[model samples]
Structure formats: structure tokens, C-alpha cells
Target: MSVKLLVTTVLLLLPYVHTFSVEKRVSKLLSWSKSENEAPTILGWCEERRLQDATELQVTVSCGDSEPLEVSIPIPTDENTLARTLWPSSLAAAILLRLPASEQLVKDRHILELGCGLGLAGIVTSSSAKSCCLTDHDEEIIQLLKNQNIPNIDVSYLEWRDEDRPNDIPPSDLVIGADIAYYFYLLRPLIDTTKAMLRPDNSAFMVVGQANRESQWDLYHNVRDGCYNQLTDEREAPWNGETRMLLYQLQMFKWQVDDDIALENQELDGTIPIAVMIHTSPGLENFAFTTFDHIATKNDKEGIMMSF
Candidate 1:
């Protein structure tokens, strides 16, 4: 056969060989309703790439209890390495589908993802936005991102606590990350980078669970008080099963929250509960949110002066 055929044949055999070493499917339900005594659990498993037999990668995620919500994310099968994360960060996938479709995502929007271990959040975001760039300290993850074609992704090496800014990534309208608060040391510079990239007209957002929200909030608030923002709104919605990831349109000026708020968890009955947040200035001024039970974006007065 020709060189092309030989390469094709080799590629096809790789994922299967890699997949065989691990359990084919990961089955477990993880819970997000956590507290001080409980940290969310991660269940690891491997998913075979459809085209490559020897190249299937390992995926690990936290499965929530409720009909055992288990979904496998793409992983790298080479090097005989290990995989680790809180959940496969399906949050971006959850947030992406939640955004308003009429408000088309900007194609030229500069997007960045922190702790982009497997590049799932960045890759999935590119499917909705203009372009996405990913950063991580590990050279291994950078190499892994290079090997994968996740729609529109630009990869660069970065260390969170490092003094210098990441050269490989450029300034952007939005800086995207999922589950960055899992480590306390990474909070400051990560938020610092997001603030540096924040635009006056367009806002930014980071998708994280309640588990990591407090840490991110603290770091964000330290910078400009109300200049940084957070949004959490949840409701039942429909998806075409493109993947339960999420994306949003937001500016950071008019965000609101209160103590003793009622909280809810994922609904695993084959439909995803969606939260659409816009890191926008003044929360879209009487904005009408069409998807979440036809609820309007409720405004709050807690933001500092000139926050919007």
C-alpha cells in the first residue's frame, strides 16, 4: 500500500489497543450538592475514538447521583499515562447550549481556557464562539492538545503562578475556563489574566460549580470589588444532544447574589438543566431570557457604583 494507506491503517488500529487496557465505559453517579466534609468525586474511564483503534483516550469525570449520570469525555490514549479532573468539566457544554441563539456568538472573540487539561472546554466553546485558545502548565497536556483536532483551538504552555503572561495567547473579548478553583494557588493570576482581557463594552465569564465558586469569587472581588462578577441561573431546557456543554453571553458590571439562596442540582432524566449567564454590564437592562421558563434577567442593586 501507499504511505497514506499505511498511515491510515496504523491510525485505525491505535485507538482499539489503547482502549482495551482500561474499562470500556465509566459508570458512576457523582454529586455536586457538596459541603466542607464532601468534595465531588471523579470516576475515570476510557472512550474509544471511532476512527482510531489504538488511539482511544482515557476520560475521568464526576458522576452525579440521579440515574447515574455518566458521560465520557475525549482523552489521550498514548504514553500509557493517567487522567485526572473534578468532572470532565461538562459545565462549558452545559453553559454553551444555554446561551441565546438569536444573540449569535462572536466569531472573532478571543477566548481562553484555564486548566484546559484535555482542551474539552475550549474545544467545545469554539463550536459556539469564534475562536478558542487553551493554556495549561503541563507540557504533556500541551502536547496532547496538539494531537487532537477539537474544532477551533489554539494551544500554548502556561503556568498559573508564573510571573509572566502567556505569550502564546492574545487578548480577547472573553476569557473562558471551567473548574479553575480546584486549586487555591491558581486563583489570583488566573483572575488577573481575565481582568486584563476584560473589554469595556463586552464582558467575560467563567463556568464553575458551587464547589469552586467561592474561591473564584474571592479572587475576582479582590481586584475591583464589583468590577468582577458572577452569575448562576438554572432551569430545565431542551437540547439536540450536541453534548451537554454550555456557553454564555455576558458582561460583568451588573451581577448580583445573596445569602441563604435556594440551590438546585443537575436533572439526569435525559434532559439537561441549563444556566445562561452573560458577563455583561448591568445584566442586559431589563433583558428577556427566553429559554429558562421565559424568565427575565432579574437585576440586583448589590453592585458597586459604576459597576455597569
Candidate 2:
């Protein structure tokens, strides 16, 4: 929610004034086929530059369905984009690709997605589940999420770190999310809200990509111990023909007390490991909390769901 209030006041300077799904904006950027029955698209538009070199990435998300959809965006070679693409955000694409698939575990359930970059998973949940809410701090994106939703997909401006409740994710019986653990400041508030919003009878399903193993583990440890039942789900693999990195290694001690973890000084806080604090409640048996080590292996078609 760093983009909180800051972007609201500078609304006139922002390039993207309206709010909508990343897929919808990316579709406008790339002009992909708007089919009636396409899976929710994750990547809509992205421009970037690292170490002085410009980079442009566009992806069409066929999430849950995992069909590689084509995306179109200008090559970073464009002279006009040199300045704007310096630090463009890619969280929208990540949110879309990280949404979970439908199964007996999570159908017709109330779900909530945080840091909904472009409302990818939220829109999909709105379409598939009983109901869904998409939240983000930026008004522009929230505006877009609202515009894209025809009759469903509740989009709102919510800062997970804020003590104030924003009114959308409140009735969330179950929580769902991907790629939400990026910074330390954002992480604590997210967990706090999750605790406040989640119904006692519900569980949360979160997807962590193969990119950041250590960070995911830190996040896992922060919530697993007493607050949840750290179950050992069979390992899962990654898509895009890559190995699912042993991502949750640090979180292995999540079920136990993490006395070994130490906090770093302010200068290098991002690199230091963090311990998770889990607080248990009275109705423990009624709900189950755990992490699934999903080692997803893929070929040409059909995604993974290893167990029978």
C-alpha cells in the first residue's frame, strides 16, 4: 500500500488515470483476441529498465487453465518509453498467474485477494466462486478493476497495513493470494488483516512462485506455528518448464518456535530473515491451516494435481 494516498494526490501526473484489471489494460496495450471463453489474463502491460538497459515484457494469462495466451507490447527499443519504463511494475502479471484453480477444496467459497495489481484472480474468483473481492491501495487500479467488472468482482481501495477497514474483504470466509510477500512493511499488516477478516471456519490458499525461496520461507514461518497446523502436503512443481525451487525451506521450522532467527539493523533489513508469530484461537479443529509444497511439473497440456 506504499502507493497509498501518494498516487491519489498526484492523480493528474499519473499516466494511468482510470482503474481496471491489468488484463484489460494489457489487452489494450497488446490488442490480444478478446474471446468470450478465455481464462483470466495476468499480464496486461509492462515496461522496465534495469542497469540502464530497457526491457519490455507482455504476457497473456490463461490462469488455472494455463494456456499460453499471446500478448503484444512495444519493444523497449522505443525512444519514447525510455523514461517511463524505468521502473514499471510487473505485480499485475504475477497476481494473475498466481490465482488457484477450482477443486473440491475451494469451490463456491468466499475468497479475498490482496495487492490485486490488476484484479486478475479477483475477477476469476468473482466469476467462478460464490463471491470475490479485489483490493489495492492505488485508486487508478481500483478504478480499473471496477470498470472491468460487469456485474461481479468487488474491487476496492484497501491498504492491508492500515488499521482502518475498507469494507470489501470483510466477509471473507477464505483467503487466496499470490506474490504478496515482497517487503517487510507490507507483510505484517497483511497478516494482521488476514487475521481480522478470515472467518474461524475458513482456510487460506496461497501460491508462491519459484523465484524467491528464502523470502517465501520467511513468510511461511511467520504464520504457520501455533496459529495453523503445518501439514505436509506432497511437493508441487512449477509451470513454464522450470523447476519449482525448494522455495519454502526457511519455513520448515514454521511448526516449531523459530528461536534462531535474528533481526538485522535498518540498513540491511530486506536481506535479513524474519520469524513468523502465530497466535492460536479457540476453534482450532473447526479450521485447518497449512502450506502445500506444490512441485508442479508440466508438459504441453494439463496442469498438476498429483493426489487422487
Highest TM-score model number: 1
What is the Å distance of residue 74 in model 2 from its true position?
16
Predicted structure 1: clash tally? 34
lDDT of 2 at 92: 29
TM-score of predicted structure 2: 0.46
TM-score of each: 0.51, 0.46
Q: Which stretches of candidate 2 lie over 4 Å from their true place?
A: 1-101, 207-213, 226-308
Please, what are the lDDT tens digits per residue for candidate 1 over residues 218-308?
4333432333223223331311111111212111111112222221221122211222223433322333322322121212112112111
Cα RMSDs of all predictions? Answer: 15.2, 18.5
What is the alpha-carbon lDDT of model 1 when measured against the actual structure?
0.43
- What are the clash counts of all predictions, listed in order? 34, 15
Model 2, range 1-308, lDDT digits (tens) per residue?
57877777688655442321121121111111223374322223222112223233343444333444333222324345221221111322232323353322246767777766544445444544677787767665566446554355677788776778876455665565545565545555766677677665434435332232334444554554222222334332211111122111111111112223332211221111111112223332222111322222122002212111
